[model samples]
Target: MAETAVAAVLAELAALEDPKVRAVNEKQGNDHGVNLTKLRALAKQLKTQPELARELWATGESAARLLSTLICRPKAFERDELDAMLRQARTPKVHDWLLTNVVKKNPHAEELRLAWLADADPVVASAGWALTADRVAKKPEGLDLPGLLDVIEAEMKHAPDRLQWEMNSCLAQMGITHPEHRARALAIGERLEVLKDYPTPPNCTSPYAPVWINEMVRRQAAE
Candidate 1:
């Protein structure tokens, strides 16, 4: 029955695949060309089917892996399995989805986060930074905010692209949530000058750290 379900889901995904989108997806390092909107709709159809999700994930197709993240039960995965999955993530989008939808919801998240942050693998490190940013945005009660600021100040410019984006996000979160850190965050942003010259779409918040911090602070004050 699970095999049949997996086959049906795979068929549906294949039916929704677009060659043009697939070409673009390949460029972005995704292995499949299924439209994300269609994938989400398909995931809804296969909701909460961990057995089916497991089978789909084993197939190693990008869209299948994405659907697996959506349908798999967080508690059903062991630590080693999650680690293996993280190690297999090859693209930024997949890494983001796996961390946000799968790893962060799992009970082993904190332990994984701590270990992955120091991991030599760039993908794992990206997941760790993403998870940390999520935590900093939400609970943040026990986190060492000052230490985080220090790390960002010291290493952000030198960090890999994916890790740097999340680290910068963590810095922005600190400035947004802890008013006391705003000045220091701004100062750190100034010193690092990370994303300083990146062009932002009109009316979009600039990802440049100082501009990001100021915009977030202004929005918070109005709220």
Candidate 2:
């Protein structure tokens, strides 16, 4: 029964694939070509079906996994299950969507945050830093903000692209959300100059930390 349902969902996802969409996704490191808006619409239709979600995720196809994150009960997953899923999420979109929709909301979030942060795989470690950035922005009661800066200052420049981007996000979030570390964050962003020349579309904030920090700060002051 489960295999038949999983195959049906996979067929639906396969039917939605478009060569043009895949081309764009390929440039962004996403392997699947399904439109995200449509994917979300499908997820909405599926609602919260944990059994179906597990079936979809087990398919190991990127689009199926992305949909799995949507319908799965985040809290239903075991810590080890989440860890295995993270390891299986090698593609960018699936990995990111899983973190955004499932892992971040799981009760084991903080525990996994600490564990994944120290993972030897830079990809896994990037998820840890992404969670830390969320904490820095929202629930940073016990985090060592200064120590995080210390790590970013020492490691960000040489880290792999995936890990470095998350580290940069943590730095930006710290500067934007915590005034105490704002100056230090800006200084580090200046010195490292990571993403300094990243091509940002007009009116979009640059990922270059100094510019991103200042833009967000300016918006906050305005509000």
Candidate 3:
């Protein structure tokens, strides 16, 4: 059933040259969100047309998700091919997609770990940390605790209020999800005083504001 749906969607996509417009239409059909059900179906039919799937994803608003779905499909994408496509994506959404799909969950997880850690963009950097935390949850042994520490510290130094706040959430996630790492995270959080340095803005979840900051602290402390 999923294969049939994917084939039908691909056939429809092939008949049209502009997938961006199709993407808009698809989004509208799905109440202004990525059609994940359709994408998951497409992922099931990943063989024999990986490149075309990648092309369609490149033009879709839900490209990130599709890319992630594709990455999760075993044997669908070559390592170098995936890396090249990720590098070619210039949009922040695409970058985020790559972070979620390829960098974070790639079969070649170690390679992506190093690459994303070195990325200069805050969006990329934050996503990198997020992925690191996620992967650590799955496989805690031999994890790069030092690298994770470096990223949160860097976030405090270079990231904006919003990202700084996100770092707090990520840390709390790490703390709760991986208890062994909790102490290290709390130690860093206490000494950094990043929340004090940068205040949260109106209508923003900045790390400096009393409400969000306190919430983050509480979450971190939660048993």
Candidate 4:
């Protein structure tokens, strides 16, 4: 009965694919053609089903994995299960969705954050940085702000694309949240110049750390 349901869900996801969108998604290292809004709608219709989510994720289909993250019960996942899922989440979209939707809400988030930060794989480490950046922005009382700045200054420039983006975010968040560290964060950003030349659309903010930091800080001061 469960196998039949999983097969039905996979077929539904397959039917949603668009060649043009899949081409675009492929460029970003994702293999799916499903629009996120449509995927969310599907998830809402399916509702939360942990076992079904696990089965969908095991199918190794990017679209199904994305839908799984949307419908899974975050807290139901064991720490080891989340760890295994992170390792298997190879594509950028799946990796990001799993981190944002599932891992962030897991009970063992901090422990996993530290463990994954020290992970040898940059993609996995990026997830760690993502988790750390969340804390830097929200619950930063005990975190080592200066030390984080130190690492970003030293390693971010040499990091891979995925890791570099996450580290840059952490640096920007650090600057945005802590007035004391803002100038140093700005200086490091200026020195590194990572993503400085990134082609950002006119209305959208650039991902370049210096510009992102300044823009956010400016907004905070105004409000």
lDDT of each: 0.85, 0.94, 0.55, 0.93
Question: What tens digits encode model 1's per-residue C-alpha lDDT throughout 159-202?
Answer: 98778888988888888778898899988989889999987889
Compose the digit string of candidate 2's lDDT tens values, residues 69-89: 999999999999999999999
C-alpha RMSD by candidate, in order: 1.7, 0.9, 7.3, 1.0
Error of model 4, residue 51, in angstroms: 0.7
What's model 3's TM-score?
A: 0.54
TM-score of 1: 0.92
Question: lDDT value for candidate 2?
Answer: 0.94
User: After best superposition, candidate 2 residue 223: deviation in angstroms?
Assistant: 1.5
Once model 3 is optimally superposed onto the true structure by TM-score, how far is the C-alpha of residue 93 displaced, in angstroms?
5.1
TM-score against truth, every candidate:
0.92, 0.98, 0.54, 0.97
Ranking by TM-score: 2, 4, 1, 3
Q: Model 3 over residues 12-41: C-alpha lDDT tens digits?
A: 434433556556655433212334455555
